[model samples]
Target: MTKVLLVEDDATIRVAVVRALGQRGHAVATAPDALTGLQLAVSERPEIVLLDLGLPDLDGREALRMLRAVSAVPVIVVTAAGAESDMVRALDAGADDYIVKPFGADQLDARIRAVLRRLGSETAAGPIVVGGLVVDARARQASVDGRRLELTPREFDLLHYLAQRPDQVVSKADLLTHVWQIPYARADKTVDVHLSWLRRKLGETALEPRYLHTVRRVGVRLSAPEALGTSPEQGTAA
Candidate 1:
């Protein structure tokens, strides 16, 4: 059974969700607030997290930031806030998916399954090559021209995301939400900062492009010199 951490303060909602998920053959663990949820997340390492935006001890966003700092566990924000901005923010904050309140158990189950599927696909064995860089996703290790690139957890996540979809334009908004686990509106120069660090380590720059390229007003793309022969949108990151 898939293990899940359900972080919700509302007892009624929490019980309902837990029951529903349990009926679907999932092993559900409950936490009433952010602190307990964080502790459980680190200790239990659930396959996925169902996070409510409001908690008595901590704001959901703050808790999200803390969680992302330590884990890459898939998170789905279950919130009362249904505004487009709210959804965007939750995505930017690193939530794998966002489900507004009053959602049916079926919808929740589908979302949970989708997140699990995505995570499973990511962990599947494959040799990922972008430009001259080769990543063994199963090992979570990357090398450029046979020289291994030592990357921090976050940097590795960022690089892995880019490498997974080489030559595809990924907006900073998407990166901030999906990669950094920050809400999109909260996304800022942090993406740029990390990109700068990545570029420096890669021995390339936005000005003197090599592996990474900025698509004016669009986003960034990773590609190699040989891959540059195709359309700009089709370049692979080295």
Candidate 2:
């Protein structure tokens, strides 16, 4: 059974969803406002969160941003806002999934299961090691050459994904779909920006990469220094 936190201000919707999810063998906690929800999220630490955008106390997007700051817990936006722009905004704000309101319990269940599956699949295989870089999936931590790399939740997720497939070229499209939980589209520089941040933290740059190598007009590859025709002792680029 999944532990779920439902953050919705509407009494009717909250009560109905609590009952519905309970019947599905889920243990659920309810919060009527963004502040209460944030507190419950930190203290209770549910497996997943079903958040509504129309909170009485705070805008759901702001709440989502705040929650992302403290936790990497999966969150699905369950709101009445069906606009594509709203969906994009929430996803960019770090929501794991998005479901328009007026949804049935079964649909919600499916989305929950799907998101869990996608995120859980990689971590289940345990830690991934490529050269001196170690990515501990279960621990949600990473280190390069025995030095821990301080990374944001999104950065860790991206690194973990690429580390799991070392030497395999991964397109930005795949990274968007998997890492960011969004589909690929032109003019999206999100992946590029995050990769730049990750590179800096890894003590490297795009022009002089050590672990993350860019394949022009193709994608990016995470491989050992030796695999990239560089000496393992070469160390991080300045």
Candidate 3:
């Protein structure tokens, strides 16, 4: 039985989920606010966390960052926000996946199982290194040289995907389909926005590209700074 921590403010929804998960043979715990949820996360050491953004105290996103800073626990955001932007924000804020409000208990069960399966598989990937960058897939951590880079979960996944195929241009559609497991939609600026944030953390920009390079209408490629013949002073629009 997996120990799942459910963090939600609404007593009705919280009680329903907790009872349902318990009936499903899960060792479940509950918290009504973000601070209590975060506290339980550290103390309980659950296999996964289900977090609600509409907390009475701390914001769910802020709590997510705080949780990520100290633990590699898988988090699946359970929120009322249904917009794609909100989903992206949650993923970028370190949520492993998200379940919008009013979801079925079965759907939540499936999502939780999927996350655990993926996390289980990741343990065998070992670590990937290119130049100064090192990606530990199992730990969900990345570092540049000896300095650790605080990457969002989605950012780390994106970078790890590109690092697996250095110098190969991966299109935005591929990113949407693969990295995010979502259909490619027009007017969706998720990939670009994430790339921009990722670029800033890497200490470079699109114009003065070093690691991540845009292929104009194609996609982006990740490589070593020296391999791309880029100086540390390069700058470009992300």
Q: What tens digits encode model 2's per-residue C-alpha lDDT throughout 1-238?
A: 9999999999999899989888988999999999999999999999999999999889999999899888878999999998767876787687889899799999998998898887798678888899999998657689999999887767888898899889898888898787766665543677788888999999988668888887766678899887787533333221
Q: If scored against the real structure, what TM-score would every candidate get?
A: 0.72, 0.84, 0.84
Give the per-residue lDDT of model 1 (tens digit) for 74-147: 89999999886676566656677888899999999998998788668887858788778887655657888888
Winner by TM-score? 2
Model 3 scores a C-alpha lDDT of 0.84
Total clashing pairs for each candidate: 11, 0, 6
Against the reference, the lDDT scores of all candidates come to: 0.80, 0.85, 0.84
What TM-score, to 2 decimals, does candidate 3 have?
Answer: 0.84
Candidate 2 residue pairs in backbone clash: none
Models ranked on lDDT: 2, 3, 1
lDDT of 3 at 135: 87
lDDT: the better of candidates 2 and 3: 2
Give candidate 2 misplaced runs (Cα > 4 Å): 81-89, 230-238
